[model samples]
Target: MPVPEPALSVRGVSHAFGRVQALDNVSLSVAPGSFTALLGVNGAGKTTLFSLITRLYDNVSGEIRVFGHDVRRRPGPALAALGVVFQSRALDRDLTVRQNLAYHAALHGLTRAQTWARTEGLVDRVGLTEQIDTPVSALSGGQARRAEIARALLHAPHLLLLDEATVGLDVRSRREVLGTVRELVAEENVGVLWATHLFDEIAPEDDAVVLHRGRVLATGTARDIARGGDLASAFLDMTGLEPAEGRL
Candidate 1:
């Protein structure tokens, strides 16, 4: 049998703004049922790479593929098979949870019937069944985040790109969001590229990519990268940053 194509593939992709290079020959892949952590600081080119994948910024070099479809050549299908949750909250505060999802479904060209079915299922999946009729403004931060995630999955995208999905939530909420996505990987066979600066968000079994100064510094399982030490120390070591007081 032929080998399956990666769910998400970034090949030799690079981007720049004027004289500042934002990404340098960056490449990575995420397979179905896999969770890959994109480890990087604020200016580490994570957003630049995501913009290229989502076609927000055109790639000046290299190629991006979503589940065998080239993002540039087959943008329609490529985008259709991909879901994204940006760092910023995207929910409409005035709209009810169900209404927000319905609008997104319409944008995706889902029929009224399809929209209802998906909305019901996704709301339940994201643990928002009871809050489906609640206005986004009435929900807590974590609840709003869950609703946004449900909207992103409305199209049943095979690959999910979450940029700092758990930013403002408390510990319990953060764990809940992370666990929900991890469950999707196993139960729905979705691939995830979770971009975040939070080391604790990464689990030991996860595959990880370290981006520093607009380039990839390391790639391995989260545990391998940590090497029995904590992720903080490992990250500092890999990026050649001095450990404070000889410790992380």
Candidate 2:
């Protein structure tokens, strides 16, 4: 049998902003039913790569593929199989959770019946059934994040890309969000490429890519990268950041 395609693939990809090169021949892959952490600091080109993958910014060089479809050449099929939750909170604070999801589903060409069915189905999965009719502003931070995840899943995309998804949440909320995504990989066979600047967000068993200065420095399980020390120190070793600059 032929080998299964990677869930997400970026090969020889590069990007720049005027004079500053943001990404330099960066490449990585995420397998189905697995979680791969994109570990980098604030200016490490994580968001730049995300923008290219989502087609918010086209790639000037290299290629990006989702499953078997090239993002640029086959945008519809590529994007159809992908889900994204950006770092920014995208839910409308003025709209109820149910309304927000329904609107999004509709925009994706889901019929009225399909929209309602997915909304009801996802609310319970994301633990937002009771708050489904409440405005986003009324929900707690964790609840709001869960709502965003639900919105992303409304289309049933095979690969989920989350950019700093747990960034401003408390400990418990971060754990909850991580748990929710992990469950998707385990039960639904979804692939995840989660980008974050925090080391604690990465689990021991997770495959990890250490990116710095727009280049990949390492790729392995988080535990292997840590080498029994810790992810942070391992990053410090790779990026050559002074101890004082070591926020990751």
Candidate 3:
């Protein structure tokens, strides 16, 4: 049987900023309904790759395709098929939760009725139904983060990109968001690319790609990459860095 084409395909993608090379010939693919994690340390080009995928910054070489559509040549359609939750919260603090979601839906060209239905569904899914009308500034950090995730889903994108999404989140909040993401992958058949340094955020069955010094050092299932070692130690070994004291 022929292998199905990946929902997201990055081919020979490389990026640089003047004298500094942020990514060197990085390439990977996300299969349909797959949950893939990109693990790397600070300045490992993870953010650069994400920026190129989302077209936040244009790369000088290589190709990025979302669901077989090239991102640079067909940005609008490619972007429409993607849902992004950036490292920085992109919500309007002054807006009510519902209002923020409505704006996002509008940006995606959803009708008012469609927007309302999708907003209600996402709010319930993310467990923010009770705070639907509350101002973002009035919500707690976790609540705001949930709201942000819900907002990202307003357009029902096929590919979901989350960048350092669990940062500053308590365990309960982290679990809540991650669980919702997993559910989205299973139920909605969305491809998920979760970028973070923390291995605990990933499931054993999740696919992992390790980036070090602007290059992809390894790609495989999380358990396979770890191979009886803890993820932190495996990462350190692959990147040629010393493990922190007390870490297995």
Candidate 4:
């Protein structure tokens, strides 16, 4: 049997803005139906890589593929197979959760029935059946984030990419939100590329990539990347931030 193609494949990717290089020869792959964490700090080029992969900015060098379709050369198929939830919320604060999802579904060219069906299915899946009619502005931060994830999945993309998904939520919210996504991978077999600076968001067995200063420094399971010590310790050591990498 031939090896299965990864759900997301990025190779030799690099990007720059004038003299500032945002990414440098970055490469990583996300296995189908698995979760891969892109671990990096604030200036580690995580967002730049996301921007390139999502086509928010064109990738001038290297290649990105979704389910075997090249992102640069075959954007349609490549993009059709991917879903994204950026660090910033995309739901309209004024619109009800139902309205926000319906509007976005329309943008994906989903018909009324299709939109309704997916929304109904996902509302319960995201634990927002009651909040479906609630305005986004009225919902809690975690609820809103879940709504955004629902919108991203409205198109039924094969792969999901979330950038710092739990950024501002409280501990319980973050756990619930992250747990929801992990369930999707197990039950629905959706592949996930989750980018975050919080090492706690990842598990010991998860496949991970460490990106620093626009470069990939390591790739392996979380425990492997952590080596003999803890993840935070290993990360600081790998990025040459030793001694002290954080300040209050």
Tens digits of per-residue lDDT, candidate 4, 1-248, equal: 99999999999999999999999999999999999999988889999998988899999899999999989999888888899999988889999999999998887788999998899999999999999999999999999999999999999988999999999999999999999999989999999999998888889999999999999999999999999789888888888874345210
Candidate 4's C-alpha runs over 4 A off are 242-248
> Using alpha carbons, what is the TM-score of model 3?
0.95
TM-score between model 2 and native:
0.96
TM-scores for the candidates: 0.95, 0.96, 0.95, 0.97
Clashing pairs in 1: none
Tell me the TM-score of model 1. Answer: 0.95
Ten-residue region with minimum lDDT total, candidate 3: 239-248
Worst 10 residues of 2 by lDDT: 239-248
Residue-level lDDT for 225 in candidate 1: 90
lDDT, candidate 3, 34-114, per-residue tens: 999998877888888989999999967999999888999999989999999988788999999999999999899999999
Model 1 stretches astray by more than 4 angstroms: 242-248
Write model 1 residue lDDT over 1-248, tens digit each, in one string: 98888999998998999999999999999988799999988788998898899999898799999999999998999999999998888888999999999999888889999999889999999899999999999999899999989999998999999998998899999999999999999999999999988888888999999998889988889999999998888898777766542232
Cα-based lDDT at residue 73, candidate 1 = 90
lDDT on C-alpha atoms for all candidate structures: 0.91, 0.92, 0.88, 0.92
